[model samples]
Target: MYMPWPLPDENWFADTSRQPEPDHEDLRLEALVAQRLSIDWTTRRQQITVAVQNRVVILAGVVSNANARQVAADLAYDVPGVFDICNTLRLSGPRRSHR
Candidate 1:
């Protein structure tokens, strides 16, 4: 009589002993936020720095004006996994009046 092969145990493919890396999610969120900011026209993407921790995004760097700063925050918020935005962008100077 021919016999069929036995199947492996449920844990055969999985290494349950290892814990998930915590920084992976943070890094992914950071990249997403950064990409969003980079493509936007309102904010100075090159001057901005993006950081993520526990799903919270921190925007740090120099922006042209208050509107740019707010735009950065809004862009970050558009990311799917972003929990909060810490906008620390500083304005270069007051806007000059155009004649």
Candidate 2:
């Protein structure tokens, strides 16, 4: 067969892996998640942190209650391109109160 251009070697595609690279997509995801959490009334006042890597969303920081924690996770999950959710939210203060 006649070729106008030289064909590349196999090594040309060797570096193409499925590993996630730090790019604008990750930044966009992070911003979207943060925006969702900030706008939602449940997580509006909570100190929740959102991080995205390889389309996976990581929710961290402390919340006032379990509902807030779940809300954060849910909001992150709702974002597009979110492959998975890592919820590491902790409840602030003691679990139970005594008089």
Write model 2 residue lDDT over 22-99, tens digit each, in one string: 779989999999999999999999988888888889888999999898878888988888899999999999668686
User: Runs in model 1 with CA error above 4 Å?
Assistant: 1-22, 44-46, 94-99
Cα lDDT of model 1 by residue, 1-99, tens digit: 998665775555677789666698899999888888888888644489998878989888898778888989998998887889898888887678999
Window of ten residues with lowest summed lDDT in model 1: 4-13
lDDT of 1 at 56: 89
Model 1 score (lDDT): 0.84
lDDT of 2: 0.87
Error of 2 at 60 (Å): 0.7
Report the number of the highest-TM-score candidate. Answer: 2
The deviation in Å at residue 72 for candidate 1 is: 0.4
lDDT of model 2 at position 96: 81
Candidate 2 residue runs with Cα over 4 Å from true position = 1-21, 95-99
| Count of clashing pairs, candidate 1 | 0
Worst 10 residues of 2 by lDDT: 6-15
lDDT of all predictions: 0.84, 0.87
The clash count for each model shown is 0, 0
